[model samples]
Target chain A: MSKKDKSFEVLMGELETLVSTLEGEDLNLDDAIKHNEEALQLIKLCRERLDSARQKIDKLVQSADGEWQKQPLD
Target chain B: MAQLPELNNTLSVSQITGHIQHTLEQDYGNVWVKGEISNLTRHSSGHWYFSLKDSGAQLGSVMFSRQNQSVRVEITHGMEVTAHGRISVYAPQGRYQLIVDQMLPAGQGDLHLAFEALKKKLDGQGLFDPTRKQALPPYPDRVGIVTSPTGAAIRDMINILSRRFPLAELLLIPVKVQGEGAAAEIAHAIEIFNQRQDCQVLIIGRGGGSLEDLWAFNEEVVARAIAGSSIPIVSAVGHETDTTISDFVADRRAPTPSAAAELAVPDKIELDNRLSNLGQRLQKNILNRVERHEQRLNAIQGSYALKRPVLMINQASQRLDNMQDHSLRMVKEKIGNYGSKLDGFEQQVKALNPLSVLVRGFAVLSKPDGKIIRSVNQLKVGDQVQVRLSDGEVQSTIDSLNSKKK
Candidate 1:
């Protein structure tokens, strides 16, 4: 599955689930390795999402016509 | 004499005055009195005497300068005020008055009473129920803020939120935090945020202020708006000691705006540490699995079933070597027997040798014409013969033969 679309929380959750599954018994080596690779990918994606984050701040203002809209704030 | 006994129950004026003092002081201690101030007198002894009255009744009041100094509002004649203190009795005059320790403008005092009344009404409606409080999102992608644009509350919240988690977008709705219609403004901002539905959480607060300054958050409008919000709101109204009605109805309460910001987001450093730990565990687990499999393979390879062919070959070679040793030993024994027999044959051949016999004087005769004289009857009178002895052979004439009786 493509992990780029997943949110940080979702990716972290999937990584946790996969790691726990790999920890369980009765899994074959092939499936274990596959899950390991996927979990690693999820970790990378989560780290990137966290590291690349830059906060965006905005102010809600009313126009002369009385329409409310967001204006970017520093 | 009977009337004189009843007259003994009459009390002294001082004792009666003391009783009245205790009764009035005990009953009216720690009371709040609201009235229009009249007959104000600032004594040279740092005490002010006044009377609090509405249209129907008036009560004598006195506030020492020490207590009045802390009163923020200016108190004047005919200005409505609320005074808090105990009743004190002047024993000599037999008069009781309120001893004021704190005073405030009538409007601000009314706000406190109103706060209590609204708190009770909303509590009865279960607006402050824990079950009604929504759980704040663990990770919010967007946060809405309702506060004064120019205040430290907004700045502190922004700084803290950015430091903790920079992933969430902040949408601020700047509103007047106090004064006329401030509560309506705050309520409107909350409604707007709810309508937008983009923010996962909202922070509504202003920095520490006087009760009147923080009164907007205690208003019913703001409290109801916070309670009715679909998005979870964190109320951060004032200092740690100050609690507002909005704090009660909110999904979560923070003592200050900065604390509310912290409550709304997860720390990125903690997440990073968790991710690193999980990665290590995963790698360690996989490595352990591979090592176990390798051990299993080695065990299988070393098992007797896999080595059976080489074992069988070794056993066969061992048996063949034993048999070879047995046959070689028998052949050696037979050769030993033949060697003994050959020695016996050599002795027997030596005994049959003619030279060995002739050494004892034995002789053999042969006829020169292939005839030999053996007996007198078969032999003619003369015959040529050859004689062989151990040392020589000779030809001679046969002269006679003697025939003897058998």
Candidate 2:
């Protein structure tokens, strides 16, 4: 999935599901390896999403054109 | 006559007044009076004197300065009030009046009524349905706050949000949280937040206040606005004990403005810990998976087929050699039997040889004409006779014939 579409929750959910499959008894060697790889990718994505976040504040303003706009909450 | 001073012995005014005073004090002591206050007067001594009057009658009352200070409601003329105190008679005036120790506005009217009415109306409309509450996003990109621009509530919320989750952006839509147009202003701010896409959540509230001060939050307009907002709204109006209509209708209700700030976003420390935990779990789980697979691989590699391959080959070759030795031994035994049979046949042939019989001393006789004669008459003509023995041939035909015939 695209990074924009991959919410932390969704990626984490998929990662958990994959981990369980990898831990399951029925998974063959090749499939387990594949699941492990995918889980790592999800972890990386989630970590990046968390680490890169920065806090901000904004003020919402209405323009003469009858549209809403955001300005810095100075 | 002197009949007990006319049976209704006219008592002295002092006696009658004292008796009346005693009766009034005893009977009307610890009384509760409910009426509207009129002729209210605040004495220069910080005392209050008011007449608790309804349409029918009025009772004079006095609350000492100490008592007035203790009373929660300001005693105002025309305000309905309930007065509580001991009733004592002003014996000189022959009137009984209450010495008021406490007074309360008969009901927490206006604001309280408005709050209740709005709550009921909204509740009937299902605006306060628990199921209608939106789930706040675990991680909101931005939050919109509808509150006063400069207030303790805002300060508290800002500090909390910054410390809790710096990852979240805040959208502060400053509005009056009390007074004349506060309700409309709050509603407008909510609408603005709803129209904007930046804020995923909203916190609309103010600090603690008296019911009147907190009336704006109880306003129907604000309640409906909060209920209608697309973004989830957390209402943190007044203190913990206070509940406003907005509180009922909002997606979530925080007891205080500071609590609202806490509810707005997750604590960064907690999120950090959680993420680290999740990372560790992932690592451990993946490692376990690898370990299991490695074990399987080791098991296969340790199997007899894969291990000790040279031993297998040696065993097969050894069996082949054993078969070869067995085959060779069988062939040799058969050949020896055949050789023994051949030897016996050769001996038999040797026994039947004529050369061997001749060597046993047998002889043959023959005439000179190369015909052997056995009869004496044939031998009479002894011109020449020849005899053959095992060693040599000889002729004695005449002598042999005479002796045999006699």
Candidate 3:
């Protein structure tokens, strides 16, 4: 897998694991710290993915020559 | 016959009917009858009375509480049934009736078969697998509902979800839930929701209804649509006992549409309580960790290595003490040596004492005013002088005065 894809997978896995861990009781401090760190990493990865996707969409929309246009945020 | 005498005998209807009832009960035993049921009535006394009819004839049937309790299928009009009972006469009513002992359905209905077929088809596709199901998001950002816009189910779901989790955004994907083309519309709505990505979770359902009314959810198209969606779907089609293929394919199945809403979103109050609990737990964990580290630190600080400052300082203290003793001894020795040198210098000074000079017997002269006369210029004509040897002095007068430049 590409780095982005790998990161995406890891992000999703980390999110799933975090949710499961949070659903349970008896959390160790070490585990909590580890999960929190993982969640932060996943959130960063997701943001990056979203930004890249937005960039790709913008590029596609810009290349298209048509009356329909994408509007820019104020 | 001897009965010919009854030509003149009078008899009441009840009396004659009781006589015939006694005679029929004595003649026939219990028998089973196959016929179509009609005009069924259930009395408050837990008894069922209906007319059992064939194409050629009809007869009244009665199923008492004791025998009716064993029948599983409901007795409805025009139901083909086989009933086991004995033909009996009602003495009071003067009417003949069949007392049914047992009954069984003779054929399956079209709707029941259709339901089973749909259930089997969805089951074969692993759509009903519990492992393939995704859990509902604890706090969905948006909840999409697929149903009739003006339906009671929608209203119920809205009311429930809003009351339970008011923070969630609700989006309605209105579509016909019944009649022709409803299944297609529902499928299209689900696809649209998936494409829009406007909802975190989807609840596809309608309120309770008859088999035909809820048939849209049982359609294969709707079931596949639910199963194929990227977003997790919750199916709540009918009453608790009612099942549909959509329910099977959905990630979660709720008994009713309102229940599906409840399942789709969590109660804000409960979540707040849980978050507060988590906060408390986090605090407790941190405090316990700090306490444990503090105990370890206290144990380390209270060790013998730290408790006794002398242990660490003992070598330095000993070195200081040794240096102090050595310095004191050197000072004492220096003092002794200085004392001897001082005695030698004292002896030398005594050798050069003026008293020793006096013991050498040098004579001295002085004037009477206590002036020493060292030359003849000191001797005036009227001056008085004293001549001194080493121990004594003599007073004398000068006869002449002389001036000298020396």
What stretches of model 2 exceed 4 Å from their correct place? A4-26, A41-52, B1-34, B37-53, B57-79, B82-108, B301-311, B314-406
Question: What is the model-wide C-alpha lDDT for candidate 2?
Answer: 0.80
lDDT of 1 by residue, B259-352 (tens): 9999999998998898899999899989999999999999988999978977999999999999999889889889988988999998999998
DockQ of every model listed?
Answer: 0.52, 0.39, 0.07
Cand. 3: chain B TM-score? 0.59
Worst 10 residues of 2 chain B by lDDT: B397-406
Error of 2 at A44 (Å): 4.6
Query: Which one is best on TM-score?
Result: 1
- In model 2, the clashing pairs are B385-B395, B387-B394
lDDT of 3 by residue, B41-117 (tens): 99999999899999999999889998899786788999898777788997667788898887877542345556667
By TM-score: ranked, best first:
1, 2, 3
* Winning model by DockQ: 1
The lowest-lDDT stretch of 10 consecutive residues in candidate 3 chain B is B274-283
Residue-wise lDDT of candidate 2 within B282-324, one digit each (tens)?
6786677778778998999888878688788888899999989
Clashing residue pairs, candidate 1?
Answer: none
Please, what are the lDDT tens digits per residue for candidate 3 over residues A15-51? 6667467446577657766665565555555545433
**Cα error, candidate 2, residue B285 (Å):** 1.6
Q: How high is the CA lDDT of each candidate model?
A: 0.89, 0.80, 0.75
